[model samples]
Target chain A: MSVETRTDVPPGTAAPAEARRMLRTLARGTATPDRLRRVGAVLVVGCVVFALVSLFDGLARSGDVRDAGQRIAVVRADAAELYRSLADSDAMATSGYVAGGIEPADVRARYDADIASAADRIVHAAGLLPADDPAAEHIKTISQQLPVYNGLIETARVYNRQGLPLGQSYLDSGSKLMRSTILPAVDKLRMLENEALSRAYGEGIAFPFIVLVLGIAVLAGLVDVTLREQRRTNRTLNLGLAGAAVAMVLALLWWSVALLVGAAQISQASTHRTAATALDDARIQVLQARSNESLVLVARGGGSADSEFTKLLEKVLGPNDNGGLLADAQQAGVQVESIRSAAIGWREAHRKVREADDNGNFPEAVKLAVGPDPTGSGATFERLDAALGLALDTQRKAFDDNAGAASAALAGLMAGPTVLALIAAGAVIGGVARRVGEYR
Target chain B: MNTVNARRPFVYLCIAGVLALGSAVITGLTPPPAPPSTATQEAPPPAPAAGCEQQKVDSLRPEGPLPPPGQMPPGSTMDTILKRDRLIAGVDQGKYRLGFRNPTNGELEGSDIDVVKMIAQAIFGDPNKVQYVVLNIADRAQAAADGRVDVVVNSFTVTCERQKLVEFSTAYVAAAQKILVPTASGVTDVKQLAGQRVCTSRGSTTEVVLRKPEYNLDVVTYPNLPDCVLDLQRGRVAAVSSDDIILAGLAAQDPQTRVVGGALDEARYAVGMNKSQPDLVRFVNAVLEKGRDDGSLLASNQKWMGQQLQVVPRPAEAAYRD
Candidate 1:
């Protein structure tokens, strides 16, 4: 009655102006029942969306974390065992051949066991990986070649027992096949597994930015609604709006705590597990290289054998001009200087053995090549491998401790987020519905 | 009354559902991981040429009586050997009993080694003064041609191509190329081995014969005879074919294996010397003649080959070209 009439100077426009003023009033009063209900519906839906998004995100990330942890602990361990078994088999075969007369029964048994272990590991590891995985192809190659290598070794053994020098050639063929084909494939499989692990680990700790922004936006909108209510109704607080704001804030806080804890754990695991794997790789390479060296002498391939062992040694340790696995370990924070020094000693001892053999002092050469004397090249190689073994043990322990903690930290995180998300969504719906009720 | 309009909220719910579904698909349908480096399998090396069928191997005839020990004629290769106080003979240390070192004694003792020692004794009267230089099957002739050794006695098969490079002594042992197979491989002869892999030493007569157009057999060549035996054991090859003497040695080693097929070619074993060393060739021929007259040659063959070979004392009849 008042505002439109107070404008009393315009009599003919009174009807239209009154209508206009009513429209303005309706527009200004956002607490009207229809508008309140609409706003409450939107807020409730927003909370539901946010809850679902956060829950699924947490669950997916936790899955990645769990997968990576399991692979590092189990799959990588199987691969490492395969590597060791192949190298050990090669060494035993060479030593048995070099034993001269009849191969000792224990040495023969050990060779067979090592071969069996390698085959078992290949089959087990292949079963775990998908068909399309690159490691699977490598596994198939090793599986196919293993029997051929074993057959060659058996032939060498038979010929050796017969005192035929052709046995050495057979042994050479077996060793060459192992060094050039099967072991390299295993090495490649191990590398692919490590790469997969790192990828999964990387994905596990990524932050959920969209979830955080949406949560904050919802909280701001709730606060604005509460303040507007206070201004219009002279109320100190709207319990519904206040409850919604608290729920949004609590949801965000819980998300933050879980993310921070998971991030720390993943970070620790990544650092220690990657370093440990690198050290193990280096150790395995050293073992294979040492086997190559022994086999060259066992095969007595002469100049060609010498050069072949040199190439293999360079691949494992380093060339005199550059660095290889030892260099890689050093870069990864492992103390491998002792291993390097021991390898150098091995090379020197091998040179002396070569010199004796070339000088036609074959007995002296055999004594220097495989003798149990501390100064023999074989002894030096043993010392080198032992040092690498120690290094590997240290790294392995560190990896186990850190990765275990990482897995434990992610424990229950997936389900915890889902539960929190559900409670937050329920609370938001309830709070917004109460405001709609007040409007009614 | 306020209208209960649910259209806007419904639209928002639809958008949320679509976004959620999109993300799930995105996460679930990731492309497969790439394979690691693909290893290239090792390719086999090039094989030697297969000689023509008409090619004949002509060896020297070792005729004449050996002079008394240390009583060589003046200006002869034997005199040269006597002055040097050592006979450098190229030998094989990988052939089973034909030319292999004794494992227990670490001494080079084989039929070939025995023949060379007798020659050394005829010149110096001491077998210990001989120096053995190990040579492979293909390099034996080259070693003699290059004068890197005085003689190559490592199972040299007298062939036309080899005779062109070096002079051959009379064939000391007659070996025929034969097939060795697993006991129950269902392959009794070379005819049954068509389209199947047969292993032999590289650059040997057996590999050459197997590669001929008529056989159409797949031939796998190895660096040494033992490797062929290994391939046969693994069933990678259906059979291993080489000189009968070599097959006999291999069969003796593996009880499950036997010499199955008949002779494929006649491989004559002879010692090789450089073409420029005529006096040395003549002296070696003389030594062979004297060894055949005495019982020492038969003894040498028996001592190493008694188990696998019933070696007949049929010294190669000598014929001179000049």
Candidate 2:
């Protein structure tokens, strides 16, 4: 009846005694309506802020994931266009040779289109990336150098048109520029984009742990407060406050568990499976395409044909040696071994074609390899394509799975936090009102 | 309670602000330095002085006070032939009569081939002591600069700028730049080819001449004259233009092609040596002078090149100075 009598017994109290008295008073419910309302407001505000921050963080991470995906797409497109340009150039050269000097209009058109498309994609990619990024810098360098290379090609074309001896020089200079500068830059850009993608994946999946811990802590604190209030009040519940607490706890639990599961699934699908596999496949595809094209050029018959082709073939298919193309491919750690092996078979087939060509047996080599019957470089290209396709498929699946999980884990999480926080506010307010009513 | 409680939020704000400021300072003040392995080092000091030596041959005193035989510059034609056991001189592997590669052995053999061999003979006293270094049209200058070859004698036309980097003996072959076109193309001169594509090999003086505003022809460049001819036959270009001798060789190979223009510019081919090696230049000039006087030059020209053009004239009397 007189819990207030402790006021006189507390003078000169020991520290533990003081703490115990304070605890007992708290247990006895000195909480007034206004104080309860104030405390509830603070708790509600804090939870809401926390929830909003988590939502923002998740959204930011989602942005990173999206950006990474887009960048990869751009890179893939650019690489494809570059490959098309190189192939078209080779085709033009062959056609021109066969025609004795005149490149077919269609071949020229194809070459032009490929160059234009590659340039457009490079420009678009540059726009997409920040100026400071290495990929952007590389794109800029390529863009600047393209005109110089084109100038040389134009000079060659003009000379060829005029039946002049200098056309070969122009073609040679242009080819050298492409080999030494543009291609290397593209390679570097691809590597940079891959790095960016990895960073994005990390950002996308990083917040789950922090959110889980915070959610659990807040839920536990609310529950403890509710039970203590009930025990002191000698009531089954402060109905309003109890309802709010229950809602908040449920929402928190749901969000935490749902997000954890979703995040795990996304990590498994996107980071662990899809992106990794896709990147590997893409790299291999690039290598195969490049090697195939180089082989075609090196094999084009002339003085030093055998030696040049042999050197290039060895570079493409041989074991790792410092500064060798094959060594670089290995360092890239793509599926290069199988690709190289396939290249070796292609090279053998190409040699047969060359022999046939040299022996004035064009139809035989063309029929045996590039023919519709499927036997030569054409078949090898198809095989390489299939391998790349498989790799791409595997990585794409992985990406989708991880992204889906990440996105799903965050599903309904934003709403859950807000609702729970409001409920907690309601419970504290209601508990204080009940106490106030009883006193009155 | 109202005033004190209001002050509490402000205190929290201040604390948060301080923490943020501290974090910013820490992050902003320090950045890790790039590792040494990642840093690009200065390109190794351009090969030692042995790679570059002073010209010892006095052009003014062509016959006086010349270095004794076999005492040429360290990296001269003679020194290189002896050291590498092969002559590494630029020779045309495309020009059939001048210097074309023998398809069977891939060895270059022709008039120009004989010239390089003569240089080798002069150096090692053995005409067979030569290693032929094949160079594309664009690479001749670079090959010489990078020390890839001892000299560039691939019918190289001497130029003033080229003289700064490499020394030249007395002009051995005289030719002129000309335009080669299809006999059916009706192009007879540079004037007729205005606005039309004229092809020339890169790094050749022909390109420099064609690209000049005076020529006003759309200059197309190829790695070699053969490619230009190929391009011309394909109608990818309107004409193939290069030195008259090269054009003549192209014309000879393919009956459909012919040199259409008179000499666009006279080019005197000379033996190129590293500019720093004057002693070697003197040795080469001495041999050339001897060949000129003894009629061996004429005999070799007739034997290898199939024609006697003109022997280089000897230096005439001039006012002597101290």
Candidate 3:
């Protein structure tokens, strides 16, 4: 120590080796200012690294939540809307076929709107999905098959107007195509979009473990170094090191609180997503039941249309009409009572439709099934569908609000880590420089 | 200081773990939807072999001229129908020119429909009093047995087997099974189209005849005659075989097709009634007696099918089982 160990480097020695020797010399001294300065330098470098890592990671996470809230949710809804419109279009077409004189203007207009909306949604949804996503293939299949289905419906309409039974045949083939091809594709696309939305949610709130670890380690190092210096100098506190420790503590605390809140919001949003899909599924079943009912009359009770109605009815109301899809939807926190009651009423009306047909009162059956009776199967099903639509809207709004809050909670998280870490680095340098200057 | 706040991070982590676990548990409560089944049901096994030997069976006889409209005999089926004020007639709406609903006006008009109107006119005095119920060809006998309809005028063919479940009136119209083909195909004979796909209405006598191994042809059956015509038009089948009248109506709608081939089997079209309702059968026969004598049934056949088919319709002469 008296010889001033490693204070001067030997001539021709490399700078790095000289520096290493100096660090070793500083380590050998107990309660020395040089060692305190070395510890402070390490803490400053740790703070710099932590700052860079958290800054980029925080920004990326914020972006993920924004994309999930805005982009993924929209695409998911578009896929759902596409499925509904296609099914509704077929129902309208079948209804028009049964009403058969000249096509009813309202039915025809509704069909046209459904087709137009379906096409529009397909285009919009395709644009939003990533080019390499598996969802793209399903979108392609639906777009290709839709026009073919429409052509068949048009041909059927012409024949129906002319009172040709072949028109019904054409209509049957069209519906077959829709069920076999287009609907299945839309179903797949919807599933894929939902998966993407969930992935975004998971990524948005994932913990930044490395940054927090580095932050805690730097704070501990600074505190340990400052305490030794205080004891060595017989002083109570070092202002510079104390300031750096405080900055580290505040940044870590803010990050933890913000992420926790954001995670809660994102999780709630996911719940809404679950509820919405349930409602969407119930709505689809309603449309299909309507289609099957009308086609039975249009085909004049041929084929398996009657049995198909039974199967579809069971799908919604369960085997006994007490619980099924509506029950499942209820478990998802959606209000299904309205849909359930309307469905029960619709079931009763459908029973009368079948009875009249069985009793050889075909005109009476037609009147009960499709006539302007306010309590008929058609009107009751319409009410059920409306209720489902309303429930879906509520869930959608809930999802949007929660998702937006999730994004908002991430505020300042990106800048906080970087700014606080820079402040810590400055304090560490200032505190160590003061001691080293006194020794000089 | 190290011990004082060291457990704070652990506490926060515990809270976070609990929250995440709760969410996962909640999500797991909903079982994911099962994938839709892709399998289609197989068609029902071919109908049971004819239960009885085939034979020509004359329908019930007309005991007297039909009671005057609005003056039905007490305790008769007609009287009950008059009390209800509407004759519920089960008919096929798909058989064009026979019992089809006219799309232009939504009115049921055809030869078979004409028979129903006559019966209603006889009982209720107003032809408009009849309420039409469109039935599948397979349901005609069961509908009668159950008393679900007052009468069936769906171009029904009489056979000994049907007599077990239903009673029939004197034939108001006569028909024979024939094959229809696209005019462009130039295939005139059923034998020439052997080994080719042939279409017919499901459960019809023609379906039975086409499946006979000797024909050596593939057969496809739809719910109605027009459906077969569509298959033929789409080239999915080489020909459609059905009653000549129904085939004639289909050919009339699409001029590119024509009815050909000889009559494979002949059947008499009569008003089908419940076996228990012998009085109803007699009443329907009385009404048919008027149509045959007055040539009104022939006039209807001519008016509905004359342009489509050149052959003049021959109504069966009145015969009596009792």
Pick the lDDT winner. 3
lDDT of 1 by residue, B1-322 (tens): 2333334444545555565566658867988676556567887676566353453444454436677788877887778878877777888776777777654444676788888887888888887677567766667788899877788888788888787789998777778888999998867888998898988878776778888878778888876787787677667999888887778777877788888777789887888999998877877887877777786777777766777766543455555565
The residue-by-residue lDDT of candidate 2 on A1-440, one tens digit each, is: 24564555666665666667655544344356444444444445544554664566556655665565555545644654454454445444433433334655765785688678777877777777876776777787778888877777787677556544345445655766776687767666765675566666665655454544444544554555556556766668667656765766676676557556755765554443433433343444334343434333322332234454455455544444233444443453434556555556666666776665444343454454444445565566556545545544555555655565565565556565656665665665666566656756
All candidates in order of lDDT, best leading? 3, 1, 2
The CA lDDT at A71 in model 1 is 58
Supply the global lDDT for candidate 2: 0.59
DockQ of 3: 0.16
Every prediction: chain A TM-score: 0.82, 0.68, 0.88
With a 3 Å backbone cut-off (N, CA, C), the pairs that clash in candidate 3 are: none
Q: What TM-score quantifies how close candidate 1 is to the native fold?
A: 0.79
TM-score-better candidate, 1 vs 2: 1
Fraction of the reference Cα-Cα interface contacts (below 8 Å) that each candidate reproduces: 0.20, 0.01, 0.19
- The TM-scores of all predictions, comma-separated, are 0.79, 0.55, 0.76
How far is each candidate from the true structure, as Cα RMSD in Å?
8.7, 13.5, 6.7
Q: Rate residue B133 of model 1 by lDDT.
A: 70
Off by over 4 Å in 1: A1-31, A104-159, A162-181, A207-268, A271-274, B1-33, B36-94, B101-109, B115-152, B163-171, B181-197, B214-216, B231-239, B255-263, B272-295, B311-322
